[model samples]
Target: MSPSHLLALRPPPDIEAQVVAFREAHGVRDAAAVPHVTVKARSGLDDHLCWLALVPAVAAATPPVPVELIAPRVFPNGSALHLPARSPGAVQLHLDLLDALRPTRRFGYEGPHMTPHLTLALGRRDVNLDALLDAARLAFPQPLTFTATDLVWMRKPGPGGAYQPVEGWTLGSTPDP
Candidate 1:
């Protein structure tokens, strides 16, 4: 598929550790599977408070492609919907972070909206949500903790609303009041 737009992120080392810990704690080792404790949706996730940014971006950029998400959860779903895309004061912080880190956009920010979340999975019209739920239940039955400290800007193959970041923001850093 063609590349998507750009998204900035704040990936934390602890969050990565936590995901691995959660996966092992749940005893899941399937490489093809997502770690437990991440959020997911059956219909789609854009409507979720954490995912308000992604749905609108998709609608604006890939309106022709229908995107569906599942229920909300608090783990890095691997997608960006529920991954805490931005903090309470992300807009200002993002600008500050860029200045702080000298982070480059890589791909300029161009989307209907900028949503940041810990993505778990992507939605498809033909996906069987029941199966997804079953998988999620077996993996993460409880919540896990993670921290955000840095933002990662990635470059996709295309422009405007195509690409996404893993996690947007977290605690224990320069955050909003």
Candidate 2:
């Protein structure tokens, strides 16, 4: 089976380094992976089809989104740790992409229910989550704001495979310097 594809915004290098350090300190295996906020998750689609759909969708997307990474929050079941973010622009882009790619989309988009976040780590149920949360609170006491300037297309070759970047699109009128 072909790998799934998703659109996401990666964090700036400084913040990304902090995220990597936190994950490594906690013994997470994928510590070196990029820190990103998932804009859309599309499953059951091959790379070629996803790319064809993304090209036009990206063209219509809004310019670079201003994002603020707030306090860390866990998922309902405490399976993941993430920094909550506020980005209306990102949300609009997501909705626009959904509309453009609806025909080829295999799953329903989150739409208005989307909660934008940058995942820090996925923890096991047996782990001491309270400690992790406390550490996270200290590590991310202040909010960090930055421009989300690009949308990255990522794909995994198969189940359990790591996602690899396939292509990218700049968000604003100005291209990357």
Candidate 3:
């Protein structure tokens, strides 16, 4: 299968280090992965040109987004623990991207209903939700605040491949080659 592509916000190095440490402590399978809030989930993005064309314009229109991860919570299915973020700016960016990439097969989560979060443990059904939640609370007594300055184009080679950066665009600035 072809690699999947995604768009995400890379937090500052310090914040990322913290998240990595937390993930490692919690036994997350992707412990060494880059900590990010997925703005667009994995997909073929067959309209690659359309996304590339629209990103710069939309980015230029948007400013650095404020991302505040409030607290840790488990999904309704009792799997995956994440830190839910409240970022109106990020949400707006997501909506703008979706509209700009119109007619493309909408993949993964989309629209205003999507929650921006930093995944600490993803797709781990064997974890004890309550224990993990308690651990997260203790690990993060206060909210983590940061500004998302860049939108990264992430690509994963094949099904189990790690997502790596293909390119990035600074919010409100032009994209870099």
Candidate 4:
């Protein structure tokens, strides 16, 4: 790969294992193959902090806000806007992944939903978003990297399920200059 070329990365084993456990405990199914940062409410904003994880780049990622040729608009910019407010570094990457896999609506708001989060445990209703946020932050400063070049419709068991390595598709590459 050249200086301009980006290679895909895989989440470290520990991270993958944790997500798997969370999935099982919650009995989740149909998780997108890519990774994402599970977000939770923050101190000020009624929003969640993008947690640790990766997702497939349905489209190329916008730069790390600081390293952009032309920054996309947050609102008035339309699709040109690369990403919303991100926590810089890895958190930003997770945001990008979520941005790529977000479900698009028809004849409606015409904007991406702010729920840019990776589902840790699925099918579970009793989730403390606050607690989840703290857990992710504590594990932070974790320098990890992976290329989410593929998207998959995971088939994990239901009701405290298990996710198989399901099918995957390439999603291009992102090189961190």
lDDT of each: 0.34, 0.73, 0.78, 0.33
- Per-residue lDDT for 1-177 in model 2, tens only? 666677788888998899889878877653215688878776433556744555444643468889999999888877678898899977887777766666444454378668888877766655666788789999999998999878887776776565667777777654333
What is the alpha-carbon lDDT of model 1 when measured against the actual structure? 0.34
Mind giving the per-residue lDDT tens digits that candidate 1 earns over 1-177? 343222333334554454455435534333212322221211122222343333232222211111122333443343222333323334443333333323223223412233434444444344433455455555545543333333332323432232335443332333343
Off by over 4 Å in 3: 47-50, 175-177
Candidate 1, run of 10 with poorest lDDT: 59-68
Output the lDDT of residue 102, model 4: 45
**Deviation from truth (RMSD, Å), model 3:** 2.5
| TM-score of model 2 (CA atoms) | 0.83
What is candidate 3's lDDT per residue for 1-177, written digit by digit as tens?
776777889889998888888878877665317788888775435535456766777777789999999889988876478899899988888888787767446644678888888887766557676787899899988999999988887777776676778788889986554
RMSD vs true structure, all candidates: 13.4, 3.3, 2.5, 14.2
TM-score of 1: 0.36
Off by over 4 Å in 4: 1-14, 18-115, 122-125, 141-144, 156-165, 172-177
TM-score between candidate 3 and the true structure: 0.87
Q: Summarize candidate 4's per-residue lDDT along 59-148 as a digit string, tens digits.
A: 234332121112112233222111122334334543454344343322232224442234333222454434543444443324333334
Candidate 2 residue pairs in backbone clash:
none
